[model samples]
Target: MCQPPAVALSLTVSVLAESESASAALVVPHSPVGHHTDLDALRAWAQHCDVVTFDHEHVPQEVLAALAADGVELHPSPDALVYAQDKLAMRERLTALGLPCPRWTRARTAEEVEAFAAEVGWPLVVKAPRGGYDGKGVQVCREPAEVEPWLSGVGEGGLADGLLLEEAVDFTRELSIMVGRSPSGQAAAWPVVETVQEGGINTEVLAPAPGLDPDLATSLTEGALRIAGELGVTGVMAVEVFEVTRVGPDGGTRAAYLVNELAMRPHNSGHWTIDGSVTSQFEQHLRAVLDLPLGDPSARDAWTASANVLGGDYAELYGTYKHLMARDPGLKIHLYGKGVRPGRKLGHVTVYGGRSGDLHSLEALRERARHAADYLQGVVTE
Candidate 1:
C-alpha cells in the first residue's frame, strides 16, 4: 500500500510520543504561517527535505518566494496559492480570467462600501482580504450603519488591508468540486458535491450532488480543471461554487453557477472520498504535490454522505462512539483528537452504499451519517 511521505507531516503534533517514531521526524516551529519569524524555522526544515507542500494557505507569500528562490521545491507556487490566501486577490483574478463570479470591490472607507452597496443593493457581504476561514472575518451588512464597525476598524489598522464587499448572490444551493493537478501537467477531478452549511460552517456534504443537471455538472468539473491549469496550481484544489436557479419564460427552472472561493488543499468537502471513492483526496494531494502519477477519482459507491462532527454540548465525544458504531456498523467515524469547543470541527462521519436515483435511499444514507456524527457530538441519543 502506498502512503504519503513521512517527511512532509505537519509540524504541530500534540502527541509527541506517538508521532515521534523511527520512521518519522518532527520540527519545532516559530509563529503560525504568514508571520515573518515563521519562515526562519521553515527555511531550516526545508533544507533537509526533497519537496515541501502545505496543508493550509496561511503561509506568507514572501516566505514561499524566499524558499523557492533558495531552490526548495514548493508545490502550487506562491503565485497560484495567493488566490486562496487573499479573497480580494482571488475575486480580481477569477474575474479577469472571465470565470463566472459575483460583482465585488475592495472597500477602504465607509463611503466606498456604501457606494458599492447602493449600486449592487444590500445586504452586501464584507470579508477580510486575508486570514479568514470557516465563516470568520466575514459579515453581512443590511445597511450602511451595519458596516461601521468594520469601517472604523480599518482606520485604526485593526482590519488588515480593508475589506472585500461583494453582491450577495441569490443562489439555490452551494456546490464544490475538487481537482488535483501535478507539476507535470496531469490533472484529475472528483464528482461535484452538494455542501450544506449551518451558521456559515459546512455541516454536511452529499456526493455527486443529487439531482444535479448533467450539463451543469460537466461544466463545473471542466471549470475546476481549467482554473487549476490557468493558475498553475500543482496540488489538490477545491472550488466552491454557487448554483443559481431562475424561472425561464416557459415557467421551468434553469440553473447556473458562480465561482465563490478557492481552497488549494485537501478540503473538508472531499472528506467523503476517504471511504466512498476509488482514490481518497489525501492520497491524491500527496501524489499531486510529489508529481507522481495521479490516482482515479471514481466513486466507490452509488452514493455517499459526510456529516461534520462539530464540538457541541457534549465534551466526552469518545464515550458516545461505542453506541454510534453499534447503531450503524457501516458508518465510518473519524476523530481529530482535539479538545471540544462549541462550533469547532472535531471530526466527521461518512456513510456510503445507496442507490443514487432513489431519493429515499439517499435520505437514509444522509440520516445514517448525520445520526452517527450527532451522537458522537452529543447532539442526540437513542
Candidate 2:
C-alpha cells in the first residue's frame, strides 16, 4: 500500500531492494475514519514521491484534486478515479458508454423503492450510493414489506442518501479479470480467476478458472481492455463479471457475461500473484504509476488458489502461526495488519506449485489452502 509520496517509497525500496529484509515502508494517509493519516501530512509527503497510486479508492476526491492542482502526479487521475469511487457516477458512465449493465434505478425513499421495484420486479437488489464495501451497504428486497423498515431506520438521506435498485441475477459463475496499463499505452492482462462470495464478501478465488472456454476468456479480456482504454485507466484495475445463462428457442441454453463492477487498484483477487506469477500486482502498480516499463503477468506455476480468513475471532486467532507452519510448510500466508472485526478481510493464504502447465486441480488446491487457514486460526488441529 506504500506506493505514493516519495519519502515512504524511498524507505520501502531501500528495505525491499536489500536482499536481507522483506518488510517495506507503508504510508498511512488520511481516511474517512479520522484515525490515522491526515491531509496535511499526506500533502507534505507527496512532495517527495515521483508518483502516487492506490490500493483502495477511498481517498477523498478533494485531497486528490488539491494534490493535482499543486503538480502532484496521481495515476488514473482523480477525474478517472471518480467512476470507481461513486457507484451513482459509475452507473451513469457505464450506460453512456453503452456497456451491458444490470438495469437499475435510483430511489431516495421507501415510496420510490416500491415504485422502482414495481417497474422492474420483486426480489430486487438495493445498494447505497457511496461508502459501501464488500456486503455492508447492500440488501435483498423481496417486497415492500422488507423495504419500509430499512427506509425508516436509515431515513434515506441519513445513511443512504440515494439507493440503487437492480434486478437480481442468476448466474453460472462469477469471474474477475485484472488488467494493467502503463502511461505509454503498454497494456497486459492476467489469467482470469473464478470467485466465490459468501454473505456478500469474497471468500475464495481459483486461478485460471477451470472449464472457462477459450472464446469466452478472449471476449472477456478484450472487453475489459477496451473499457480500461476508453476510461483512460492507468495502473492495475479489476473488472468483475457475472456469467448469466438464458434458455434458447430450440430447447438449449446460452451463456452471456455482464459487467458486475470495476475496481481500480490492487484488488484482493490479484493477491494470488504473490506466489503464482512472475510479477505481483503490487510491483506492477509501482511500475505503472511511476511510468516505468510494465512486467510480464504470466503465471510461473500451473495452479494457484486463495482462501480468505473472514469474520473470525481475531483475539483468539492471532497467535497460531506455529501450528499453521507445522502443518503446511509450503503454504504462504499474508496477514494485513488491521484489527480484525467480523468480515474485515484480516488476511489471506495462497497455495501453488506444480509443473509449468500442469497445475493441481482447483478442488485439491482449495482444500489445502482452507486447511492451512483453519490451522492458522486454531479451528483445526495441526
Candidate 3:
C-alpha cells in the first residue's frame, strides 16, 4: 500500500523521476487499498515498460485488457486475474474446479438471502462483491435484519452484481500457502504458515504452522500449486486457507481444510520469507512475472515469526527502532516508507530461530518478533 493515488500522485511521480535508480521507470502512485487505479494513468505508465506486473488487485479489469491490447505483456493475464478481483467469480471458479470453499450464494435481494440462509443456517457472512479489504466489506449476520444496511443502497433495480454470502466457517486457525509460478508452468511453494488476525487485520505470522500435520501440509502445498496452474498465474500468489475441525460419522473430531481467499500478489502473510527463507517472496514474484528461473522456497530456519508494526500513539519510530536493534539483533525490520497514522501499517519485523546460536524455540521466536514490532510501534516500552 502506497498512499492514495489522487492524493500523492504528483509528488510520487516527481520523486521517482528524480531518483537515480528509477531512470528507466515510470511510476504511478497506487490507489489506496480496495480501490481501482486510474486507468488512463496506468495505461500511460505501462506504455513505457516492456512488461507490467502488479503488487495489488486494485487495477480495473478494463485497464488490464487495454494494457494487453497495447502489446504490453501482463503477468497473471486479465482472464486469470478476474477471480482475484471478484470474490463471486473466485468462489464459482473454485467450486467448479472441485476446490473446497464455504457454502455460499449471491445475495441479490433479501428474499434470496433468506432462502440461502435457510439452507446454510444462521450466523452467515455477507461480503461486497468488489473493493473490500482488511475487514471492510465483510460482515457477520446472525439474523436477517443485519443484512439490510448493505442491501439498502442498491435501490429499486437491486444490485446487478449483488453481494456475496457465505456460511461463516468455524476454523481452528488460518493458514496461507505462498506459491510462485511462471508462464512455462513451473511452480514452487513455501511452507504453509499460520496467520494471526485481529479485527480483520493480519498481525502475526508463524511459519511452518507449528506442529502442522505433515500429510495435510503436503496437501495444501500441492493444492495451492494446482490452483496457480489452473488460474494460469505467472507470479507469486497467496492462497488463504483454513484448518477446521470436522466431526466424523462417529462424532470424533477430524481436521479438514477449506479455501478462504486468493491474493495474486506478494502478501503480508509471506513477509517472514524475507528473512527466513532461501528466497524472499518479493524476489520470487519478480522472477515469476519475468518468466525467469524460479528460486528455492525452502526455509532458512526451523521457525520464523513475522509481526506487523502498526502506527501507534507515539509518532517517533526512530528511538523505538533503535531500542529494538540494540535489544534483538536477530530481528529484521522493513519499513513501508509511508507517512504514519494511528493504526496504519507502517512496517513489519521478522525473527527466526531453531538454530544452534539462536533462540531455540518457536515460542521464543514469536515473542521476540512481537516485542520488536510492539516496541517499534511504541506500544511497549521495554
Q: State the lDDT at 166 in candidate 3.
A: 92
lDDT agreement with native, every candidate:
0.82, 0.73, 0.79
Candidate ranking under TM-score, highest first, comes to 1, 3, 2
Better structure of 1 and 2 per TM-score: 1
Clashes of each: 0, 3, 0
1 or 3, greater by lDDT? 1
Question: Over the full model, what C-alpha lDDT does candidate 3 score relative to the true structure?
Answer: 0.79
lDDT of 1: 0.82
What TM-score, over all chains together, does every model reach?
0.90, 0.85, 0.88
**Pairwise lDDT winner, candidates 1 and 2:** 1
Off by over 4 Å in 3: 1-36, 155-160, 250-252, 355-360
Pairs that clash in candidate 1:
none
Model 3 Cα lDDT, one tens digit per residue, 1-382: 2222213322231121222223112234322222235566666556656557776676778878877888878888898888888898999999999988999998778998899989989998998877777777788999989998878854322234888899999889999999999988989999999999988889999988887878789888888999999989888999998898888889897666899899998899998898889988877877787688898999998888999989886766776766778898877888776557888888899988775324348888888988888787777888
With a 3 Å backbone cut-off (N, CA, C), the pairs that clash in candidate 3 are none
